[model samples]
Target: MDATSFILPLAEITIAGAIINASVHFVPVGGAPAAMATSTGVGTGTTQLAAGAGFTGLLAAATMASQAGVSLANPVHMLLIMLSGAVGAMIMLGLTMLIGQIIYVYGIGIVPAADKCEKDPITGDIQKPYITPGTTGHGIPTVCFVSGSIGAALGGLGGALAYIALQQLGFAAAIAGVLAVGFFFMNAVLASYNIGGTIEGFHDPKFKKMPNGVIASFVSSLIAGAVLIGMAMGL
Candidate 1:
């Protein structure tokens, strides 16, 4: 293989890592608080939510790419694969938020509210009044749902791109899938650490630290890509 082959795939891997890191910042995570209707977002950690959605997307993209006559070299096919990933991720996260919303509203008897902002940026709904005393917020608000959806899409895209880069580097399907999952987790964890704790999606103050995570993921990904390339050469 030529220098271009190595360089291009390496670049894709690096960008995908950065994008995955950025995507995590957009997801709303309320941790233990949301589980008890004390805070906003889904009752989960960032890495788990992101990994679940990202893996779904990765599976969808891989399935699409593996179809007969599908060529990764073809731009149209590539776009379709990426779209498949994004849609898969969106569906998974969307349903999760929806179901969580149902439980929060009907089961837990708490209103969906965002404490990070007085007004939702997407729906322009007032947020402050719905919140309970001594609690951050309750349930996944409209803004958080929207933000999570966007994050899922980006996560899917990043996972798909990383898988594509691995395939381009000549790894088999099984190898590529395993490597992609590891790659996804690495970046996701980096972003999660940057967050430091629960966050209320993009509207939260924690989102401001996204750039730091992205930069870290980029550097880490570059190193990982180099190692993968070396492995490919050996193969």
Candidate 2:
């Protein structure tokens, strides 16, 4: 009912949105082409991949936060909750990339390559020579894997922040979770649209468009946060 109550969560939601959007840009999404070994990264959209990992992290954080003696009001406890989310998300994305890499390398028999750069930014391996003549690239390279994991971590942290803000507004765990999921998807989709199609990771030229996505998410989340505050007032 007070301005402080409304403003705090609103600010948190806005910042979380921006973080989620930026995180999506760090992920390497190769889309349908990647499924067939014609491009780099996991064979999915940025939104899907980010959301998947984010939700998993959210679940982990919620589990930790809900435990007896855990106090969200304590900064250390809050940090631990957020860190749990980040670690959970990283593990989810790591396993996902690992499995995809296995299939890409062993099942499809394609060498890991990135078309965006002449050489692997991390491994320093020649990229172009390994890529198939007709394809942009193939398989999950080391840089892409690292970038995706970083993105997943950010996504988890963002999701946890949103949930914590909602919980602070006095919403029940279930309601706060649903709201957080919706909030995460809204920002994730915005980032995906900004990507326009595909991205290879942080090193990809498409990463430069991240600001556009972050701005869009920030504005959208502000509106969503207002609606949430109105709902909280009723509750």
Candidate 3:
């Protein structure tokens, strides 16, 4: 491997980290409050949601890349692999939100509302009136669902890119997959820490802090990329 190989993979890893961090910002995480129907979004942390969706996407992309005729060197093939990952992630997150929504509406008997905004950005529904007093909100709203879908896609794409980069550097399938998961977690955690707590998707004020998380991921990724290059050299 020469300069281009080293530079390209390093760049991919770095960019993938940044992208993953940004994606987490788009997910709605209501934490403990959401669990009891006192807040919006799914009742989970950002890292858990992101990692779940991202791992699904990573598996999908890896499966596609392993097809006999699929070549990572081919730009079209690469795009398809990434798309496979994105779609997988979207499906996973979509189902999660859908099921959670059902429980929130039917079981909990509360309307889906967003506390961060006065009205729904996508549906134009008034949010304030539906919100229960003393609670931030209840259930996932249309905007949050849309934002989470987008985030899942991005997470999948980023995870796929990292896996691809590792494969390109001559890492075996299993090794690359493991490394990709570790890398994904690293960046996801950075974004989660930046979020500090619950968030209501992209429309939330906390989303403004994305750049800080992105920067942290970028720097950490660069260091991780250098270490990966060294590992590849040993292999």
Candidate 4:
């Protein structure tokens, strides 16, 4: 309605976009190589994995916010909503990694290994020894698992923040939710392209390129935020 109301939501949208982009970079995506056990990480593109986790979180947060006595205007209630989102994302990604691990180990008969490092950064296990001669690595290793979980949590938080901002601007829940989803995807896709295909989470050298993705998301989000503000004015 006023300058203060419009400015706050725009800022939140911009920050949420940047945060979503950064979160995607933390996830480990192996693309085609991961599917055939030739690389480390989940067998999918970065955008897909991030979007899956982010949407789950968004739904979880929305559910929490809709509960009685959970007012978004209250800081504690908002925090609880964001927490629900983070936990939801963690559960989804954790389950995915666990099932994928089971398939890679027992079903495919290959030891879990990391291609980007000599030893597991988190567990300190020697990675080179377990990897097959012809493949880069197999399964979700400790580092990848941890990194993916962290990424999921952040992605969920970002999604929740965007939704919260939209709701704060007086949009109905359904409209806010749809806008948040679109906003999340825009940032996630930008980060995925910056990755250029595959990444082994934080341990991978490609993680160093995160600044590029973040900057891209920032600029794009600012534009999206302005557009949303304009729409809000009409509403």
Q: 58-158, model 1: which lDDT tens digit per residue?
A: 99999999999999899899889989999999999999999999999999888899999999998999999999999999999999999999999999999
Model 2 lDDT per residue over 129-218, tens place: 999999999999999999999999999999999988899888999989998999999999999999999999999999999999999999
The lDDT ranking, best first, is: 3, 1, 4, 2
Clashes of 1: 0
TM-score for all models, in order of appearance: 0.98, 0.98, 0.98, 0.98
Report residue 177 deviation for candidate 1 (angstroms): 0.6
The residue ranges of model 2 lying beyond 4 angstroms of the native Cα positions read: none
lDDT of each: 0.95, 0.91, 0.95, 0.92
Off by over 4 Å in 4: none
**Candidate 3 per-residue lDDT over residues 168-215, each given as its tens digit:** 888999999999999999999999999999999889999999999999
Overall local distance difference test of candidate 3:
0.95
Deviation from native of the Cα of residue 95 in model 1, angstroms: 0.5
Candidate number with the higher TM-score (3 or 4):
3
lDDT of 3 at 108: 91
lDDT of 4 at 178: 96
Global Cα lDDT for candidate 4: 0.92
> In model 3, what is the error at residue 25, expressed in angstroms?
0.4
**Clashing pairs in model 1, backbone N/Cα/C closer than 3 A:** none
